[model samples]
Target: MKNKRLIQKRRELKLTQKQVALAIEISQSMLSLAESGDRTLDDANKIKLAKFYRVTVEWLFFEEFYD
Candidate 1:
């Protein structure tokens, strides 16, 4: 499913897909796919996103605890 939380968090940080991709060492297209629900974030990237967003991986990937 599309990760609205990820999109929201990225926007809240005033970040772009390119910026987050570069910071996490992934391709911008990959980030785009993940955000769009065409692909899921791998475990490593999940950790990277959590760290970048200053949240836990569970909070980042699990909609049940997103808030």
Candidate 2:
């Protein structure tokens, strides 16, 4: 639920889970876990994701976008 936007943004960038994982210094399994809503991102990961996506942290987590 919370990370749905992250998934969308990644897809929009044409990036695979492995690619994003590498960018965030995480493993593919961890990325998969986050995408599946099985886990939440820690503070470090939140920062990494925000930087990697070039979006604000609030935007990454809370902004709604049209599909």
Candidate 3:
């Protein structure tokens, strides 16, 4: 699934792709690929994003399904 939560969190914080990428030490294009779900975040990057957004890794990357 696409990382809608990640997109939402960034938007909610009024952050630009470049801003986030710079803060997290990645290229803007890399972050774009991640946000678009064309690339997966490795564990280290996941931790960085979660910390940057003040959320848990699960909240950033997991989708809850209803039974």
Best by TM-score: 1
Query: Which 10 consecutive positions of candidate 1 have the poorest summed lDDT?
Result: 58-67
- Candidate 1 lDDT over residue span 1-67, tens digit each: 7898889999999999999999999999999999988998789999999999999889888986745
Roughly what TM-score does model 3 have, to 2 decimal places? 0.89
lDDT of model 1 at residue 14? 96
Residue-by-residue lDDT tens digits, candidate 3, 1-67:
5688889999999999999999999999988888888999899999999999999888888756411
- Candidate 2, lDDT over the whole model: 0.84
Query: Candidate 1 — which residues are off by over 4 angstroms?
Result: 65-67
lDDT sort, best first: 1, 3, 2
Clash count for candidate 1 is 0
Q: In order, what lDDT does every prediction score?
A: 0.92, 0.84, 0.88
Among these predictions, the greatest lDDT belongs to 1
Better of 1 and 3 by lDDT: 1
C-alpha lDDT of candidate 3 relative to the true structure? 0.88
lDDT of 1 at 7: 98
Question: Which of the two candidates, 1 or 2, achieves a greater TM-score against the reference?
Answer: 1
What's the residue-level lDDT of 28 in candidate 2?
92
RMSD of each: 1.3, 2.7, 1.9
The list of candidate 3 runs beyond 4 A from truth reads 65-67
